[model samples]
Target: MSKGRGKMKKDTNIRIGTRGSALALWQANYISKSLSKLGVKSEIIIIKTLGDKLTRGVLSQNRNRGKSFFVKEIEDALLNYEIDIAVHSLKDVPPDMPDGLILAAVAKREDPSDAYISRKGNFLDHEKRKSIIGTSSPRRIAQLKHFYPEFSFMTLRGNVETRIRKMHELKLDGIVLAYAGVKRLGRKEEITKKIPISVILPAAGQGAIAVECRKKDRKVISILKELNDRRTSIAVEVERRVLTKLEGGCQVPVGVLARWRQDTLLVSAVIASLDGKEYLKEKSVMNQNNWKKKCDDLAELLLNRGGRAILKSIRK
Candidate 1:
């Protein structure tokens, strides 16, 4: 029995853990294909997380429950040696990782913008008054309020397909979702409009898939490194550092978007109150070689300029 267990641990096969949602499976299969190209094999194990189980309440209401609501269970599986790696939607991951876990690689990013899916024509049409939009993200709600103060929003829960279904079933005027998820599921045709990042910055690490493993799993890390996109990883890291410095959680009404252009990395971020009555926006640019310093400076700039107070108000 001991020898059999040892063999299993030493096997070349890698087991990947992920949420069972359609978008998650798509990400897992993508990793699998990427590994296959390198002569490695992998199997995906679907795991249900606390976030997945809580299908009724708005995520903001459960913010106090703690961060890592979506990735906790999968990380547990990895710690117990049940899965060699875990795949997560980078935006859902908290900035601080568990003691034994590390984000090993980040896949290439897709469009990081949010999509507006509306049944009643363009959502931004000034003629559309008193429109009801569906979203569960405080970030989206606060930012949208800043742009279209007249629109009312309701808490939208469920997977992408379920949310779209509910949009029709509930007779909602429109819904907001990540462009990456819709594009991954091949539902791009349903997008009524792509909300520009200029008007609404994306969540930190949005549109990127992260692969995590135990810190001691050097072999798996080495195998996964080939899939990491350097530019995407750097961009996401800058955004995540801002969130970490701000001590923001996944549900906080904070939005950050970062990109690399020419020889510079530019980051735009916002921290807003739930009511959108108070907010702060900061844009920082620096040479790519000094990305870390730029991220720190940007975070500090926001914090000093009412961003700290906005965060405090949100917590209260």
Candidate 2:
């Protein structure tokens, strides 16, 4: 690594920009620690995002407030050269990055599955009681409604600990969260069930951490390259491509997961109505060498099978 002031000033530590949430801080610190092991020092700079500005009550009232709600500010900071690199929860990152910025690295993925947390051990046991579950994700609410129509759902948004606390304060039966966040935050024991992927296909890039930097900065790009996990990078690339082709975002009830099966890639996706009355799912397996083309093909298949109508209805 070049320490001299060519692209950057001499002896300057890499400035890592991130959101102010606990999980976001954990992600930023994780990257900083990884960089330290590589003989590169870093500093974490917390930035408040649009999503962070809204109260949980206000956010719950407006499910689709804005696109890239959690990342736009931090990305802007990176673009303005206020920070050298930005670490993001990959699921919160949009399918298309802002111009002149690139996704430089993807850390190894964690569980990438949704988890159910409740006072009791199983969500199914509450089916007879017509229990309510708390979660703000349209994808999760739609899929859960598909399986358990009798149960009601309420919108709840916050960090993992805050959500769990709200479950008690709000007197809700339980809540749904990404298992990766629970495990990463050391709250795995609170998980009632690690819902199977077959039950709930995760949002694209659910469990991964992304490192992004200015495309023109070779020094920062070179430093980030060492953190890339090829398998994780390729899988998320396929997942994000499917999302881009489908034109899905936080408001759209879309779920996609891709993983390597031996030497081939296995991908699955679903698009559903908010009421769970209409659902479309597609799966494909293709050689790793041609996953990108296969991703487009898979997306087209979904669009043809009523996905277009489903998303159109949601938009209205």
Runs in model 1 lying further than 4 Å from the true structure: 1-10, 64-67
Q: Encode model 2's per-residue lDDT on 1-316: one tens digit a residue.
A: 2322223564899999999888999999999999999999889999999898876566434445445788899888887888889999999898888998999999999989999998556665554568989898889988888877788988788899989999989988899999999999999999998888877899999999999998988988888999999999999999999999999877678999998888788999999888787888899997777888899999999999999988887777
| Model 1 C-alpha lDDT per residue in residues 48-102, reported as the tens digit of each score | 9998877566467666444588999998888778888999999988988889889
Task: Return the TM-score for each candidate structure.
Answer: 0.95, 0.94
- Error of model 1, residue 72, in angstroms: 0.2
lDDT: which candidate is best? 2
Q: How far in Å is the alpha carbon of 260 misplaced in model 2?
A: 1.0
lDDT of each: 0.86, 0.87
- Candidate 2 ranges beyond 4 A from true positions: 1-7, 56-67, 125-129
The residue-level lDDT of candidate 1 at 135 comes to 91
